[model samples]
Target: MSVLVYTENWDGRFKKLSNELVSYGSKLAEMLNTSTTVLSIGKVDEAELKSLGKYGADKIITVTDEKLATLDNRAYTAVIAQVVEKEKSGIVLLSNNNTGKAIAPRLSVKLKAGIASGITAVPEKTSPFTAAKKVFSGKAFAKFVIKTDIKILTLAQNSYEIVEKTGQAAIESFSPSVSNDLIRTKVINVEKQTGKVLLTDAEIVVSGGRGMKSPDNWGKIEELADLLGGATACSRPVSDEGWRPHEEHTGQTGKIIAPNLYIAFGISGAIQHLAGVSSSKFIVAVNTDKDAPIFEAADYGIVGDALQVLPKFVDAVKELKSL
Candidate 1:
């Protein structure tokens, strides 16, 4: 049984998340003593598809159908399930993003595969097929043992390193029969957000909380994010109060992000907020209270009024850039 990675493309192009999945799949293939095969479903270009080899993909399969461009849970699940069977893949990998979360359950049901969702690492040992993921909202870890012949795993983002290996993948075209009845979702129009970093894709994220005092005080927060070329996020309360858009909310009840660097200003670091960003590589917190919960998790912390400290932080970044 080989390893298969179901990579979802964005606008006919792959994202860094896709490469990360390929990298993880390649590692799993090595552990399983098999080859790596990637299935790309959408109207994607050949050149872009082959680029996955840099991350250790052995073979690339493309299913070019205009109807499959948009994600329909039923349709995409069928397509991936079909590929898994055709390749005789024992382990199927996907990202824990919106698309992955949407289709993983359906694919699991269709393939009768045991699913380990939101896993942060590869199998500790594949003997009994032992895999571990964060449990209880990242407060702890739990290991799962699957006896099923087929295993489906959805990996958490930013958890695996993307490694490059020498190989030029052989490309193959796949045309799976997608029943029209399975394509139930219809797209009317797409409103694209332009000229800002996407929170999910950002390496660095600057966030503000209710401690910012007023919505008018967010200028410095946005400026800091812009200076660092990162995305802007907020606590859930900030979103609920309409101080910021709901899309910027990051928490257990909202978006879960694990950026390389997460900076929190005016956020008190409630457990709910920590649940979302606890996985960040580096956390920088600035709050007035020294006993704020954020400091416990922060790699670097400044205890002072966030409003007072923000201007200084902005100036420091500007000075460093000018130098």
Candidate 2:
């Protein structure tokens, strides 16, 4: 049985997260002495599907249907379960995002497989498969063991590095029986977030909290993000105050992000907020309080008012860029 990785596409395109899943699945397949196969749903183009081979996908199977455009948990689970059985997938991988959270458990139950959600590392053994994951709202870690015939894992975002091993992928299409009755949800409208970097896909993120004091004082946050080619995010309070959109909210109660470099301004670092961003590779915090909880988690800290410090940072970066 080959390793199966479900690659989620966005408007017929793949992102770094998709490449990451394929890479993780590929390495896991090598550990298991098997091949890695990718399953793509939705309307992805042929060339885009083939490009997955660069990330170590040996074979690609695609399913395209208009009814499958919008996510219906039941229909998606059925589709994945059918693929797992047909391909005899010894292991299945998916991203631990909203989509994965929606259906991973159902897929496990349908296929009678053991599932480990939010797995952060690859297992070293196959006999009594073990996986590492975060627990207690990122306050601690735990190792979970899965004992079953087949193993299904939902990988946490940005946990694995993307590696490129280019090879021509064998492409083929699969037609799963997705009848009308299976789809319980219907898409009435779609509001696309365009013209800016998708926060989840951004490697670097600049975030603001309530310390800025006013929504009108957000120019430097946006300026810093633009200069660094990163996306902008805010704490829950900023969103709740209507200073920013809810989509930009990052915290345990909102979107959980793990960017390579996370720069925070004026944030007090509440436990809920820390739970979401604790996984970031590097955190730089600028807060007025030296004792702010964010300082404990930050790789680098500056005890200064963000309102006074942001303009200096912006100018320094601009000067550096001119060099």
Candidate 3:
């Protein structure tokens, strides 16, 4: 049995998370002494399928139909389940995105495989097949072992490194049994966000809180993010206050991110917010409160007013870049 990665894409282009999944899938396949196969649904082009080789997919399986252009939880789940069964895949890899979140649980029951979501690390050994996963929203780590022959794993976004392999793989076309009536989810419109990197996949994130005072004051945060080529995020109160969209909010109740660097300005670092971003590699907190809870999790802490500190920090960054 081989490892299978459910490669997710939008508008026929591969999403960044697909490479991260394939990276881990390829390593896992090597450990198991098997090849990694990538399974794509919908009408993705052949050239794009061959590019999977750069991300460690030994073979690409394209399952296409007109009905699959848009995501339908029921239809997609049925098709993926059929593929896993047909291939007798031992480990099924998935991205922990909207699509993977919708289909993983359903596919688990269909395949009778154990599932571990938000996984952070690869398997340590082979006999028991254990994988390390983050628990309590990044506060803790736990190990899970699959007793069944089939195993399903939904990896956290940006959790694994994308390993590149040279050479292309031959794309194989497949006609999976599908029901058009069941795949009734239709896409009416698509709205793309402008000028902001996605927070979930961003390596560096600069965030502000209610202390930013007003929406007009967001320029400093934006400038810092732009200079670093990263994303801008905000705390819950800022989103609730309508200074930013709810999508940019990060906290226990909001989206979770594990960027390489997380910079917090004026954020008090409530336990809930910390729970979401505690996985960041380095945390730098800038707040007036010397005893703010955020300082506890921050690798570096600066106690000062954000309004005074922000502009200076941005200027210093610009000056350093110029030098």
> Per-residue lDDT for 1-323 in model 2, tens only?
89999978988899888999999999999999999999999998889999999999999999997778889999999998889889999999999988888888888998888888998888857778888788877888888789888888999888899889967799989999888988777788998868798788788999999999999989999999999899999999999999999999998978888899999999999999999898899999999999999999899989999999999989998999983
Judged by lDDT against the true structure, how good is candidate 3? 0.87
The stretch of ten residues in a row with the least summed lDDT in candidate 3 is: 177-186
lDDT (CA) for every model shown?
Answer: 0.92, 0.91, 0.87
Poorest 10 consecutive residues by lDDT, candidate 1: 63-72
* lDDT (10s digit) by residue, model 3, range 215-257: 8999999999999889999999999999999999998889899
Position 124, candidate 3: lDDT: 70
Candidate order by TM-score, decreasing, is 1, 2, 3
How high a TM-score does candidate 2 get?
Answer: 0.96
Candidate 2 yields a Cα-based lDDT of: 0.91
Residue-level lDDT for 85 in candidate 1: 83
Q: Which of the numbered candidates is closest to the native, going by highest TM-score?
A: 1
